[model samples]
Target: MTAAKPIRCLAFDTSMTCPGVAIIEVRKGKPTIKALSHVKPNTSRSHAHRAEVIEGWAMLFLDKHVGTAGFDYVVREDFAGKTSRSNYPVLSAWNACERATSRFGLTFAKYKKPGKDTEYLGISATRVKSLVAGSGNAVKDEVEAGVRRITGYAGTFANDDESDAAAIGLAWLIDAGVIEKPKGAG
Candidate 1:
């Protein structure tokens, strides 16, 4: 029997105030985050308009990233709070990511006939945090440290929401055994 190919993934966070993206390329047994980007919106502008701005950014992100072997699953964060989530930044973030899900689905031709579809996973921030930091209540800094601990990334991670977003994808990759550990642990 032949071996299976490692799945590739592109992950991003939708936020007007803290827009970020992360992509993971898993080839063979080695998996690495190929790209991570996070940016702060202009202070002069409020996040209320992010729905539109993030839409544009989503289009740009897909235009640049989507391809033959597009993301197997586009993992993103979701909220199920009872309160309306149409707040400025929150609303904009949702709008931006929603576009990515639709586009990624089409890009992968998952919408074709039947039994063939690319799916997206909207992970809760708590779950993702727990997977990485071993605690759902892990703060952003703790999460960042966990990322570095796993990936050997050394930097401020100040704008690393994109990196963290991508990290979730990596965790899924590891959990699914699409990627393996480096060895010499315990």
Candidate 2:
């Protein structure tokens, strides 16, 4: 059989207040983290201001790192909370991400369809935790530990936000059959 080509993925733990980001590259079924970061938008302003800030940040980030053809696809953690307070940030983040990705012409075009699809996806936090940490209810610390264990990342994650994004990326790779599931992960 022939070897599989490398696939790069950009994933986000998105929020208007602070959005975490991670890029994962898979070569021959092994995963590596290419970059990781998070942005804290000025919260003293209105939601519109926060959304614009997020959109600007995402656009700049994609332009610099992703360009026109950087990764295979982008994935964000699905909003999985009951609080209405969380709605503004999540919606704003998704809108900004969509706008940024659309600007870059990045969509869920794994098949390279002909027309404008403009599709993206979100992996649930429970599913991400389950796949990465072997438990759906795993907490932030455990998810961080699991991500470190899987990616062999030595440095500490600035916060769980970054780790969660990394976990989401890794889990997407595994779920899509792009990479084999890491040992001891669910």
Candidate 3:
């Protein structure tokens, strides 16, 4: 039988100021990082402008790298509207990502193909932390360390945003069976 095509997962740790992105590719059940970067839109700009910048950036990135083939999964850290005040700005950034993913033809739900169990949308930060660090309440530093251990990545991440994006992507990979879950994970 012929070999299967490699699967790509693009994950994001979305924020209005600086959003992180990571692209992970799995081939034959082994996973590797394809790219990691963050967009730092001007904080002085209005929320609409920042959101627009983020949307444009993501569209360009997808076009240049992922192309028409697109990613098998696109995930972002869920926007938990925990505060009483309206989280309009944060929601805008998240919506920008949603638009970008939709533009590439990825539906905001789990794929419905038979025998395929892939998720495609927001994943809770607590869930991502639990999957990556074995604790739902894992701190940012702990999550970063756990990502390093799980992915066997030794290089330093530019910031926590990048590491969080990696964590989010790896967690999805494990959940989707694209990569094996690490030993001793709860």
Candidate 4:
């Protein structure tokens, strides 16, 4: 018998200052992190320049991977809807990601903050943590540790942003049934 093909997923944790991105492959229902990186925008640059930098990087990453095996899914962690006043940059970056994903003819999923509603398709943050870290209340460090443990990834991440991207990808895999839910998960 031949083995089934793996599902490829690209995930992002978006921010104005630093955004994280990861590519994962699910083979035999186990997810492996293929690549992970964080993009830091130059703070001294104007908003337009920073946006251009982010958009360029995002497109380059997608172009590099989308031509490979092609992705089965794309996901981005949704921002916490605290107040509309402070979320413009995040929303802008997220919109760029959405546009890039659409350009590749792929539909991306947005994992939302718990119990919040938004126009975009969203899954709650609690659910993501539960699926990825085995606890809905898991902190950033714990979530990062869980990702490391799950993928056996040895490389160091610049910050929790990268790890969070990995976690977001894992959550999507779990939600898609590409990966099994971990024990004690909420």
Tens digits of per-residue lDDT for model 2 on 1-186? 987767899998888778888888888777888888888888899988988888888888787788544788688777655776877678878888788888887763332112546433576777789889988899998988888877788876777778988999988877777877767777
**lDDT string, candidate 1, 16-82, tens digits:** 6777777777666666666676656565765556456676777777777776666776656654555
Give lDDT tens digits, candidate 4, residues 1-186. 988888998988887788889998988777888988778999898656777777778888888878758888788776666777567787877877777777878887654444556544545567778888888899998898788777888888889888988898888887767787777666
State the lDDT of candidate 3 residue by residue for 1-186, as single tens digits: 988988888888888888888888888887777788888999899999999999998777777777655688887776657673447877888889889878878654443223557543467787788888888899999998888887678887898889999888888778767788777554
lDDT at residue 70 of model 4 (Cα atoms): 86
**Residue 164 in candidate 4, Cα distance off native in Å:** 0.6
Q: After superposition, which runs of candidate 3 have C-alpha atoms over 4 Å from their true positions? A: 84-86, 110-121
Decide which is better by TM-score, 1 or 2: 2
In candidate 1, position 6 carries an lDDT of: 55
Off by over 4 Å in 1: 1-4, 43-48, 85-88, 104-121, 154-158, 174-186
Looking at candidate 1, the ten consecutive residues that score lowest on lDDT are 107-116
Predictions in order: lDDT: 0.62, 0.79, 0.80, 0.80
Q: Would you list the rank order by TM-score, best first?
A: 4, 2, 3, 1
Candidate 2 regions with alpha-carbon error over 4 angstroms: 1-4, 67-69, 80-84, 108-121
